[model samples]
Target: MPSLGLKGADLMCAAPTSLTLVMTDMRLSFPSDEELLSAIRGHHIGDQPLCGFAREFGILHEQLLETAAAHAEIARRRDELAVEVDTWVAARLPVPHPNASLHTETVGRLLDRIAEAQVHAYRLLMTISPDDPRVHAAWYRLAELVDGYTDLTREVIQRARRLPALGDRR
Candidate 1:
């Protein structure tokens, strides 16, 4: 059976040291970003002892927070863009023989714009510090929006295909 590698032979094979040695080594390793922030913010480590490191880490953390906020703003703008495109699509799609060429061209342009916006957002999100939970959540939301927009564009393509003269002209 597959093991969790936390006990007995698995643990021994992974690290041929006693559990106490493993625990001691783990404790000596540098703390994670969250742990560092908690230590500095909570004063778990004496201020005088870690003042320089804390200040530097604080600045980096603040920068990451600002980046996360910017990502959120970009996401909001993308949402607005999506709404605008949806409105334009709705207005034009209902008209009979609404310049099929123009309609298809507009839809393609909108999809391209959405794709570019998503790419920019993803790049910005990737620059954010990985340890920040907000970054992960924002990336996930952006991914969902990208997926939804893609699905919507596929539906638009289907609608365009159903146009009696569209495939014939193409």
Candidate 2:
């Protein structure tokens, strides 16, 4: 009866037999990628070469970088479109007069801006998870704005269309 020197309360009494079983079970378990690499490199559990693990890690790291870059580009596009829409909306808001002609121009411009914003937002939504409620809300708002602008533009265009030509038609 050799003392295995396993010191841990009740387990210490059953140490020798339990330790053997545990070691056997652990040896039978599947080795991790690192372990496999170490084995391949002629190193057991101690100091191992791990060249294979290094290669695999490198490949995964590169893929992660590529994914990050793509996501960044998408974010950049969304930001650019948002800024453009904001600028267009701001411009349309403060025009000197609320006349039919001005209204028509403003609405037309706003509609165009809304259309662009919708496209960008849609692209972003496609990339993001559908469960994101904020994106859905923003999309709805964009749609409403586009519709409103379009309706306004149509009314103005109709009114302006009915008016006689501005130039002297003598």
Candidate 3:
């Protein structure tokens, strides 16, 4: 309900004067901080108290926006620095064989395939009635497949662990 000394375009460019804007009239200036604080401290619900609170809240809002921008810039700089360090470290390290990650790739692909098969099996099982004899057989089949997959995964992990490290001829 009070003017904030800001016009149409100036509204976006000017420093915040109050927490709200209702009309574009002349800016309603407040008294000095000391006087405003004294009035606010007295806890009176008048013009000075309202103005004091609005001024402080507007300033806090601006400060919070600035703090958020600063944090985002810091995060961006940290990410850039991390990339630079990674690049430097990578350049200093020995390159591995092209197929160094083959096992991992294979494992990832197999896992994806297994997940797809399991989803299909589940859908099929859902189509059959719970009381059907075939439903019980399907459940047993799913259990067996899951057990086999778990055992296979364990064996693969064990074999991988026993393999020689990269660049080691022995």
* TM-score against native, each model: 0.27, 0.31, 0.27
Name the runs in model 1 displaced over 4 angstroms.
1-87, 94-128, 160-170
**How are the candidates ranked when ordered by TM-score, highest leading?**
2, 1, 3
Quote model 2's TM-score.
0.31
User: What ranking emerges by lDDT with the best candidate at the front?
Assistant: 1, 2, 3
CA lDDT of each candidate? 0.36, 0.36, 0.35
For candidate 1, lDDT tens digit of each residue in 54-157?
Answer: 32333333444467566565555434443443343443343233433333433322333434443444445678777677667665664564454344334444
Badly placed stretches (over 4 Å) of model 3 are 1-109, 160-170
- Hey, what RMSD does candidate 3 come out at? 27.8
> What is candidate 3's lDDT per residue for 39-141, written digit by digit as tens?
2222221453233233333333334335656655544433333343223222323333344332322222222233333444444567877777766766566
RMSD in order of candidates? 22.5, 30.5, 27.8
Write candidate 2's Cα lDDT for 1-170 as tens digits.
11222233412111111101113223112223334323222233322112222222223333433565665554444344334433433332322234545332332134234444454455558778877886788677766764664355344334431222222121
Better of 2 and 3 by TM-score: 2
